[model samples]
Target chain A: MAHSGINLIFEGQNLPRLLGGLWITIRVALIAIIAGGVLGIFLGVLRTFKNRFLRFILRLYLEFFRIVPTVVLLFLFYYILPKSMNLNLPAAEVATLVFTLWMAAEASDIVRGALISVPQHQVDSGLAIGLNRSQLYYYVLIPQSLKLMLPAMMNLISRIIKTTSLLLLISVLDVINVGQQIIEANQKQYPQGAFWVYGVIFVLYFLICYPFSLLAKKLQKD
Target chain B: MSWQIIQQSLPMFQKGFILTLQMSALGILGAIILGLMCSLCQYFKIPVLKQIVGAYIELSRNTPLLIQLFFIYYGLPGIGLKLSAYTCGIIGLIFLGGSYMAEGFSGGFDGIPNSQIESGKAIGLSQGQLTRYVVFPQGFALSIPALAANIIFLIKETSIFTVIAIPELTNTALDLIGLYYHTNEYLLVLVVGYAIILIPLSIILTWLERRIRYGTFGD
Candidate 1:
């Protein structure tokens, strides 16, 4: 062993660096969720439009995002898109873009399902009154849909957090990437250093995702 | 632009494609077995085994597959349990996929009315016999759609193997791009490669779902 034992990876300097990387991971996830949620709502509504052409386009968009793996999307945005378009975007920005695209597609489907799941009688009763299209959606549909959509949306948010780890492939210094770097740098000292490094990353993700999953379950139960 | 380059690279991609398919097949098989066993144990309310399986499901499902792959690939070796990258990838996939599949299967089991089971019991069938004759068939039938969706999900999830240097389709693309940094066609290749596999797989799953729903065994 060239360096100190496995304890060194967690000692004075490395601990704070790991924490800093985790903070970045959390920041990326939070920002992506907020942005993706807003976009998802818009796309979801677009998907449910009465116009066949609009629905077709939205379906195409959703399928495109859903079928392709996020890693491939990240690679495209991070490496190829910038070079082709002559725009030098940061890795975090690219990550946000790819994640938002993914979330929008997934969330749109959830929203559409939630909206359609609202009973037809509710819509008819709203129409039986003098409520206009905007009023009907705003007053009756959206409120009810929100109750159904919220739990699924929470699951999507946690998924976004976990998926942020893929940004490591694009050279982003998220927690996992940072852990990998530390392990590689100290590998000569601690031959099996990855155990602690990646173990810590696993715990960090579990901490973030588990609570949200519980909340989703509770909401679904209610 | 060069057929020569593509021709030379064809074998590498082919090898990768075959490995990807094999890993997926083995992973899917392992997942079905693990998932079925877990579901059965939970369904029967086995004493301590149920709790153990439940914990496994929760721990696996909540974490990302990438970290699990790293843990299995790197962590196992630290404990004197050595596994090749391919074996590690398959094991990781099996654990991850089994957790998800067990949930689906359990959901299917729950969907079966309790009356069905009670009716079986009234006929003087043993618990094992009830599960085999009455519960399992209906549960499997009802779960076809979920199982199909899970299969598609598993296929997409297999792409994570690239990170562990498993030489899957994605890894092949990464290697090609790394080798020929000048060619900006890597993304296009990846898109085409994945689309070729996934589009047909999705279609087949849809068709299977429809067939199962219609209760028409193939003619």
Candidate 2:
């Protein structure tokens, strides 16, 4: 009754464990995306502000995140931050924090691009119509920018989801971690478990992300 | 931040940096070649191969490199393909980067005007000649920015090669930290190491992109 070969992936609740791990990945990504999206929009708006000092600081912030690899950031947060700050945080929390920051940086860039892409004449007309700055942005700019930003945002969302796989390196028990555990456990019974297990995880990620990518393409076309 | 730890680990970090550079160079070169082939296949609409390339691009792009590395490093051995970690790292990078590069290249291909191709054909150029003369140069120029972005991306992705135990920058930092626990210093070293590599690489690429956009390369 021993499950052999690929069957080892399903044997004794392995599949569910992998699903649970994937759930963690999705949950972290969702939380990061939602929180990061809001922060990103605010930063994006700020990024377009005319103040040179603020823009300079924001540019530094963006470039810092862009230049530093996420894994290094993960270590900085998961290991160094706790010791330095004397705060104990879970690996998942650290993962989420780093991801949220990264997402915000990228999303802000997209938002900034989208906002700037609105025709200058549109802004001028809004201003000439006696719209206040906030009113003009709310009524004239935000709506138009949303369309331009949507496809890119969707693409970013998929990218963030794919990136959550890195959380496993920090020991967050993500889908990859779960797959590894399953493989190690079944190494004797199914020497090929890594192939099937990782293949399945790959498929799971593809199933989740491919739709978003396709949707992004469609949205761009529209 | 203890300066001594950084001083002590300077050699380790340097070795890792060089290794990272070598790996990235090989991976980027391989990816460019693979990407060109794939884009050309798509551009020509080769029968069966086009669909296969399409599927490959999606599969490669959709999955994380970490899992791909895992599959390559741990899984392939099951089928008797056993490869060294360094080989696995390069292969993994090429696999992941190839898709992105293909997209970048195909975008370039798409930018080539229909008239350009038609003109080339009217000029008595054969199919090979048309591809060589008309499409490739213009397409490559158009794709330079995207391809540069992909190059930087692939380089950043080399950070993940640590998972497969390649002695890249991140892995070296992690290893030294594990041994010494001078977390802050090593982390600083890691960031500085990446900064040294990535910042210059990006700056150079941006320069190259600008040159291609406006310099003699464009004309």
DockQ scores of all models, one per candidate: 0.63, 0.83
lDDT of 1 by residue, A1-222 (tens): 445346856666787898888888788888878888889888887777799999998899899887888888888788776777888888988888888788888999999999999999999999999899888888998889999998999888887888887878888888887888788888777777887788877888888899998898899889
The ten-residue window of minimal lDDT in model 1 chain B covers B210-219
Q: Which stretch of 10 consecutive residues in model 2 chain A shows the poorest summed lDDT?
A: A1-10
Candidate 2: tens digits of C-alpha lDDT, residues B1-219: 777778989999999999999999999999999999999899999999999999999999999999899989988898789999999999999999999999999998898878888888888999999888878788888899999989988989999999989999999999998998888899998999999988998999989877775233245
Q: Which candidate's TM-score is highest? A: 2
Interface RMSD of each: 1.5, 0.7
Q: What are the lDDT scores of the predictions, listed in order?
A: 0.83, 0.91
Q: Tell me, what's the RMSD of every candidate?
A: 3.0, 2.1
B105-161 per-residue lDDT for model 1 (tens digits): 888888787888888999999978998997887788778788887887787778889
- The residue pairs that clash in candidate 2, if any, are none
Local lDDT at B113 for model 2: 76
Show model 1 residue runs off by greater than 4 Å: A1-6, B1-8, B182-184, B214-219
* Candidate of highest lDDT: 2
